[model samples]
Target: MNFLTLPERTSGRRTYGLTSVIDLGTPIRELENILSDYSHIIDIAKLGVGSAYVTPNIKKKIEVYKEYGVKPYLGGTLFEKCYYQNKIPEYRTYLQDLGIEWVEVSNGTLDIPLDERLTAISQLKRDFHVIAEVGSKDSDKEMPISEWKEEIKVLLEAGCEYVITEGRDSGSVGIYEKNGNIKSDLVHEVMKDVDEQKIIFEAPTPKQQMYFIKEMGPNVNLGNVKLNDVLVLEAQRCGLRSETFYLGERECRLLL
Candidate 1:
């Protein structure tokens, strides 16, 4: 068998595929410039946290991102903040008015009840493609791997397009250790309970990205990617570079 000609390589867009970038504070001009060059390789662009509130030109940014066929949306932390402040209805209206076609529902910061979280997912789905996030931001309050897996099932059943495994922006907590390495045993446990296609791992480092690609393949959905690293990450995903591509190839060879 040709080692590089794996059937898994044929997966299409918006599936369990590669290179989702996080726009933590990407200026609209810079975003436009980058997208003009590399939008085809990027899958999603998240307007991270409350950074979307910083500019009066956010709607214009959303328009440009969408124009390049990139699905842009509010970060989960922003949603959690809105929900906590009882601004959810207003939040939904604002997203709709801004022409945002996707939104994230997460309980990373706040103590939202599961049912309410599910309800928010349902409501968001009526107007936008909803992605839900599991796991807590607080390292001390991390949910067990088993619980996270089960919650993924619940979210998918309730119509969430995908569930993000919380790694926060630092990648030093949640599923990752203080040193930024993933707890592979916990990852293995979660993998047993959900389809990997329905999950996006929040990997913010090159090492973390390489780890997931090596263990879960190139199609593993990754988030919290830095804006400047978008092309670099895409190169890793497509085997365009030797550093990260080496591990990706090893994993693909094993599959073969």
Candidate 2:
């Protein structure tokens, strides 16, 4: 047996493994091809932002994604938009009608009060798997680490299956600095209070992905991955193509 194969490769469909692609505007056929070839390695595909609104065959798209064993959900921003327009109940019903089992609850763009957010979480839990996001879209509106930690606990208590750290599409705002890098100390503090298994780090950059895999290990849950980077990110997690192999070896040496 090869020593390289000593550790069984981490499987997909894992809540804390591999890539979660964000589908901005890929043609349905192209999306199907990509998922068919790489679905075993891609955990989730998010119809990024409001892309779901423009897709004519939303049900067909969801069915194709589900056929490949990939979980698909509308972006958090879309959910916020629905909530702001006072169409949340309709939104929830519409998604249910579309056969969507997962939904993202976030207030990145809107100022949803805590009570209302909790209510949404509680109600959505009855019909769907809820993934709530913590953090704001505005770069200047930084959420205090203490507040983030508290909110994570509250959301989890209110029935959220996973809590995502906001990184927008650019990964420059939210938990990251203006330079598009994760604030390691802040991540460390957040991890201290929240269960890493239930926390999805929105790491869109390779450097940020490497940082999280190095700092939090390969099994750390990552989100907002670009559609093209699914295979690359999976390779990183498996130590097949990334600096993570060296990092893991160094960690082993340190332990020894």
Candidate 3:
């Protein structure tokens, strides 16, 4: 069916308007189905937390994402776990053996100081594309907006391809409040101070997703999206969903 052109979303292995989906040990066949149907919109497939450490047919799953042009990587949580276990050397070797190229260096759960985290990103940069994550997973741990801006800027300088603001898979903590609502002012402040292109906001819920879409336009990078929500997010990106149906309106574009 022919339809009006939707707002132009970045196409072909997008650098923006990216949807980084979480894969929590989806069976190989099921993963294939998702990629076959929505690979065009799926930029990064993260094996959730430490699922990559235990998922069966792990290599095949990574290969499937690559075959469909979707970059796959282990979750930053897994990297934190490896670091906590003092097995980073083995972890790097494991990723290398699997032929994975992208990696997330996060301190969401751990209390690795800023300097050490930057050092890790610099060292990891030698072997893989690094995407660092900021913000604590603990909702009570409030970080000043100025610090958020500073960390994001420095992480980019330290060789991180992008820095993720942590709104976890549960839609609580980090960029969100305890009840899962966005800290809109904080989001705005960060955008004003940092490179929006290199910041991926982890919006795991439909409401949070729409908020980012409306506030940042369709090309704002998003992360921790559920596998099933890929097409839904794409629909919203193109103004196909009711929540953002007016996105194609000239008034909306003017706001951006």
Please report the candidate that would top TM-score against the real structure.
3
Flag clash pairs in model 2.
none
What lDDT tens digits, residue by residue, belong to model 2 across residues 144-242? 889888988999888888899999889998889988978777888888967888988899987788888878777788888888887888677766664
Q: Which stretches of candidate 1 lie over 4 Å from their true place?
A: 1-12, 240-256
Q: How big is the positional error of residue 191 in model 1, measured in Å on the Cα after superposition?
A: 0.5
Which structure is stronger by lDDT: 1 or 2?
2
Worst 10 residues of 3 by lDDT: 247-256
Q: Which 10-residue window in model 2 sums to the lowest lDDT?
A: 1-10
Poorest lDDT segment (10 consecutive residues) of candidate 1: 3-12
Q: Which digits, one per residue and each the tens of the lDDT, describe model 1 over residues 7-32?
A: 24423366768566888777788888
Compare candidates 2 and 3 on TM-score and give the better one.
3
TM-score between model 1 and native? 0.90
Per-residue lDDT, model 2, residue 233, is 81
Model 3 lDDT tens row, 82-149? 88999888988999999999999999999889998888888889999999999999889999999998
> Which candidate, 1 or 3, would have the higher lDDT against the true structure?
3
TM-scores, in order shown? 0.90, 0.93, 0.96
Model 3: residues >4 Å from true position, as ranges? 251-256
